[model samples]
Target: MTNAGPDGRRIEEALTGGNMEPVVRIDDTVRRVAGPWTPAVHALLDTLVRGGVPEVPSPIGIDDQGREILTYLPGTVLDDVPPETRWSDSILQQTGGLLRRMHDASTSLIGGGRHVRTWRSASHEPVEVVCHNDFAPYNLLVTADRLSGVIDFDFASPGPRIRDLAYLAYRMAPFAEDALDDSGFTAGEREARLERLIAAYGVPFESSEVLRVGADRLLELADFTDARAVETGRTDLPEHAAMYRRDAVLLVGLSSPQH
Candidate 1:
């Protein structure tokens, strides 16, 4: 599905015009739409303007038609299995550091404002940086086992750091039983992989911070999905939404402070 405008015009012209092969190359350009979400994305890129965010595409501007233009970021996106394993210690560490930096930079922009909170578990105290809410394998660009860049900032938002981290963990180390197979591993093997990932990212095992808030995040995702489905008049997503809600409850049940 292309990112189309409300009037359904293709707006990701710059990205499509480029012949450069991105990690996750999409022939169909993301059509831009003018709305609350698009401007929020623009605000995020604005925040990253001064900081040394490596290889980020430059935003052109909001078009008269209300579409946003951005330079196409380059790198290889490792979407699944064999590619997913390409995620190395350096990449995880870099990603962790990048996230930290983004959070630090975001403090100034959204430090004290009534902003929209995407996750219900998120504290409404003050907004942190604009999180690439969908930071995952598909959105990341990798080269030689290191994170080269990121793409798809459509879900960017001002929110808590933990919310972004939890979303990453949820995507990377999902609660689904089949995720192991998708990653080309057995259940026991996948567990080991997850342990290594957490270690590589320096996520404290004893903290229980990610686990404590996981259920709420999942519920929030479910609610968001349900709302989107309704808005788009699509009934196909409710089953998956229900599954996520159930999985979130299961995850909460499995949580332990002992790590």
Candidate 2:
């Protein structure tokens, strides 16, 4: 199930790092099917690199096969870290700090012709920076007990910083219903972790605001997933949509003043 290159190196190994797309590793490079928005993603990567953000891949031009090319970051991609280490403060803090770096680096791109840029995700108002619309642990690369790199820019777009942070908090802070609460933290501990992550990111908003936004984010995700399920006839998406709605409702209560 692999191919060899002209130099006798393994040319193509199907990568299982992401769920939405088929990705392959070609020696030191990664390739995936590109879309019209790819050039803008490449531009954003270039800007991030120039802005001194570490641990992000450098985008190469498209290949003759019309696949987007990028440097392969070698590390264990933490799709779902094991329960033993899942709630570790180290990873949470590291993820928060890394997100801050990406957001800060991406600020330079805001209002610099980003309105015309083609992104897979629609731009949100009050665009302070280019948001990595999917910033959860699944997109993180870990090495030697630390964060090494981040991947998947297909959803990058101009949006409020909280839009991205809310999703991260949903996964890491784990604003989930009982069925989805796999982070091994109690309610109080989960709240504490949420605060830690927000503090690490150095954002000015209260965590209540973040939880409210997180609820809205989940509702949007549910609607999108439902539509995609109908279009693709993907059986799993309906369940995903249901889970998002349940979590969104939970987050609303958590964000309420009475809570």
Candidate 3:
């Protein structure tokens, strides 16, 4: 049996470009095998779109093969971004502002009765919004000096707004030990970066709180990765999980630094 897209054209070419999900790009759309929660995710995406949220991908209909389709967005996803380009304080500030806009838009979704179950865990607090959950530089599409869009809502779930911000701060401001070597941010610079991001997001969070949440988030990610590795029988996944576990150490090291 062959898989077909919404237009009945054969789904052509697996998009190896993605880090997760076996996505195939057919014509102008990207299709992936629908998970059980995809329908709920589609609902979330629809709400975000109907709410006029920016930086989110356009969700198309499902296909006969039970694949979810989304409009293919264009821009750069920087995994190997230059140190100079990746660590710009102004760019980080702008990116944080975008996140604030997203969080604000998502605030309307609270208690609206739309939720999906995924591997990503939510924090224990009053629900602020459904979060991107995996917001990071690699998931973001950047054009020139500004972030064009945010992608990969697969892990969207309900959580405290700051928990979402914590994950973002972990990756963007990178509240970890090797922030200096890995991201060209000095100890004091990283503190400033965390403060700048929180301030840009226009939220009242102690820079210290972001760090605490970020550390806890890493521990959760480590466990999630470990369980996935066991279930999928992927040995490499554990090593990857260990990397995040190692970051826990780095995170602890940062506790002494005055933010």
Candidate with the greatest TM-score versus the true structure? 2
Q: Which stretches of candidate 1 lie over 4 Å from their true place?
A: 1-31, 80-91, 112-126, 176-178, 184-207, 257-259
TM-score of every model versus the real structure? 0.71, 0.93, 0.85
- Estimate the overall C-alpha local distance difference test score of candidate 2: 0.86
Whole-model Cα lDDT of every candidate shown, in order: 0.58, 0.86, 0.74
For residues 61-144, write the lDDT of model 3, one tens digit per residue.
898888889987767774446667677787788778877777777666567556534523444567787777788877877777
Question: What does candidate 2's lDDT look like per residue over 27-103, in tens digits?
Answer: 78999889989988998999899988869999988988899999989887765556546567888898899888899
Report clash pairs, candidate 1.
3-31, 23-75, 23-76, 23-77
Q: For each candidate, C-alpha RMSD in Å?
A: 6.7, 2.6, 4.0
Tell me the tens digit of each residue's lDDT in model 1 across 32-93: 44455655565666667666675355566765656665655656665632534543445555
Model 3 Cα shift for residue 99 (angstroms): 1.5
Question: What is the full ranking by TM-score, best candidate first?
Answer: 2, 3, 1
**Order of candidates by lDDT, top first?**
2, 3, 1
- Stretches of candidate 3 off by over 4 Å are 1-13, 16-19, 112-124, 176-182, 256-259
Off by over 4 Å in 2: 1-10, 177-181
